[model samples]
Target: MLVRPHRSRAVTAAVAAGAAALVGFSSPTATAAPVPGTTVATTTTAVAAPVTAQADILDRVRAVPGVTKVTEATAPEGYRFFLIDFTQYRDQRHPKEGTFTQRLSLLHKSDDRPMVMYTSGYGLSTRASRSEPTQIVDGNQLSMEYRFFNTSIPTTPDWDEELTIWQAATDQHRIIEAFKSIYTENWLTTGGSKGGMTATYHRRFYPKDVSGTIPYVAPNDVVDGQDVYDEFLANVGNDASCRDALTAVQRRALGTDRQWFLDRLAQLTKEEKLTWTITGGMEQAFEAAVVDYYFAFWQYSLQSDCADVPDAATATNEQLWEHLDAVAGMSFYADQTLSNYVPYYYQAAYQMGSPEPYEDRIADLLKYPGFNTAESFVPSALRPVVDDTKAMPDVDRWVRLRSTEMLYVYGSNDPWSAEPFTCGREASAERRECYRFYVDGGNHGAKIAQLPAPERTFATQKVLEWAGLTDADPVAKKVKKNGRWSTNNQLDRPEIRGRALGRR
Candidate 1:
């Protein structure tokens, strides 16, 4: 019923050591005027375009077939938004790298104000430049994890805890550089879900580049509670009985009923009023399984101990760890490879079927990569960093930097929100150094805030205030009916579905 959803830093001149090595590659600049015709791939580079003509070029492109939304505006004196297009190659190593084009909007709010960059996370299905590009807010929540899922270099060793941490940090630095190159100033950054966690990472890494940040509905305790897969197995069985049945199936499959488990799935699809096909059904089950497994995996990774369960004893950290490890073994991604499910599944369901071949592919991926996880839709050249736990020092340092100026918003109804046992409130006072917005009955950043007009008004007002756009109280004139955040903005009217999530 209620909708749920869901940075940094800089480098030195290396003491002016080696400019050749320092400047690996530079992106072609944009121009105000359109270039004639479609430019084909070529060995010779295209000349840089002028910024003055960027709007005209965009207008011409908008008129082309299949072209979507095109917008051009001189961002206010302090803030500016620009849309750039570039063909992204998944594998820098591959001669024929698949093409990827993305739009980045920059807001340089004034020198006094901070530059705030929003990362897409609500599953943006369309490019940022599309006519009907997804809105910034989805399901009343702002995405905070775009850098990890969308913007960052995809090269990462998925299973190597240390490497993932390292690559994440490296990507974090690159993200800051990207921002600085475009905006030429320090900024505040945020997003939701993927964006949220990224916000955590950003604060964890590039603290100096950002004045503040807001991580909405993001879970930061990835070392423990961020397990979506295994946790789902333990919870989303439709009910306790369903969970029990699934657990039984998992146990049986481990023993003698593997074929039976597969057969039952087919039977359910054919006989029951099942909306999902065998493939789809398996996907769902796998997702739930992954969530649960990840939880156990965290225990093992963090505690560095296996779980043990007696015949009559309840599940322990050890048993779950073993069970999850088994699942990891079965899944090709368990090997040190890239992160995220999309690319891994892409290879499994499409390129390679056998787990062994897939493992080899993953190993190859470790050599050099671009923007892809273990299994990539496109090959990359950037080497995969396997053990990056050393980056933790940088992460913790950055986290402290942004904590002072950041605001973290979370929904109680969201499964990913961090809720500690010691503090029952949305967030503890100790954690409140950074403002944390807790929406009652809200899931992710959905339309729930609209139920009451006062809340809606407050949200709008707060956003504007945060942006340093206006000082007018959106709901100052409205009487406080019950002292709860209320709003008259129709956008907040609970009846309407506020926003939908997208894949960026």
Candidate 2:
């Protein structure tokens, strides 16, 4: 899953403030030679080196083919970091036809340590320096920004010709091949949400590239009709009162007090300066936010929060608006936010099927009925010409039949868990090493460390064993409390939630 920042002014202000604090933690900058046909941005710094000659690593990386720019930066205390841009093919099979340069971040700890390749499903800004898989395993980290995201956009985006899953996997493969020449150690690949799905697709296309993969909260094929998510919503969480309260909140937002909420939404749009290209205008965005409230509640929050929901009849407008803004923020469907996700929408509509919203349940509440399709999330210019002939049944078949040595983690309460890959359970005894874990009561933030007892041990052991780092146990070191695993220390662990539904 992609991890996108909430683009509200509040979030932007917070980011700007935090950037200043990060400046002091960074290492001396080192500028790299520029690559041809690209706008280059470099930061030069100085730092210490050991007998291993860390100083020369930059020069060696620059010598690699297709490497356009390499800049040294500060990394987590134990590692050194560099940002690199490489020239890649728009189509690997027909490379001569065209090319695009993509960006990647390399966090080096030691040459002989294990390596974790994190594949992001969307364009990644330079602000993000680490990934969840990188934190779980003791290894060097390489984070590849997916094609058409942030800095990875093709010179001339031909969505029809350039945005294929195979092409994305190939982009990861070339980076792996190039970096292996230097790292030359055990390699593991992982991602969450769409990124997790991307990692699986990479494994499907090139099983030999990485020894193992851990796709967190990764769903399999998207069941186009809302049937999958509908079943999930009906059964999510452990309390009926909380579920009913959530439904009540949605009804109030869209039904009896809708105009009041719409007036508040309009006032917030002006105060927060929110803007969207949603075809139905502010009213549609308001409706979408109501639909999103149900989704966001389970996706990122604890079920216990639902108990705090007020009854529609007795609740004040401030109470309802406060809960809505906190969970399903208005910024989610803004024009700028939607624009940032055009590439993802195209891919979902074309080859990667997306889950349809449960409109039947909210049919009467919708301002613009039938506005729940994938086409509704994107701008009019990029609406995909959905073709039924090109679904991903073959990919599904391969995952179930041949994918091995993989670990899939999910949350019982997470809606996406409704359509998890069933292959691990269906595979023969010989492929039992391919494990699927569902964290009891966990949400999208569920990780192997959150699991209880033997399950946590088993999940952690499998990943370490696969990465050839059996001696290092992040779960045991961090999660064990009084001889049992605990997830209370979530703030310290790697974040598992990917980009909200939009990127995934």
lDDT per residue for candidate 2 within 367-480, as digits (tens), equals 676564556765565555464434466677767777887888999988778888766455536654577889888877777768887887777666666777644455434533
Worst 10 residues of 2 by lDDT: 19-28
CA lDDT of 415 in candidate 2?
79
Q: List ranges where model 1 is wrong by over 4 Å.
A: 1-49, 53-116, 120-124, 127-188, 208-211, 222-261, 264-402, 419-433, 444-462, 472-504
Q: What would you estimate as the lDDT of candidate 1? A: 0.33
Work out the TM-score per prediction.
0.43, 0.84
Instruction: Encode model 1's per-residue lDDT on 1-504: one tens digit a residue.
Output: 001110000112221122121122111232122221233222222324433323443333333321122344454332233343323333323314332233333332223333455553322222222110011111111112222233322233222321133333333444455434333433456665545555555565566655455566554431221234234323421235433433442453333433543454445445533332212234333232333332222211211122222221254434443444343322212111112223222222221111111111122212222211222222222223222223433443444433455555655434444331111233324433444556654444533242356654454344433443333332222212333333323222222111222111
Whole-model lDDT per candidate: 0.33, 0.67
RMSD of 2: 6.1
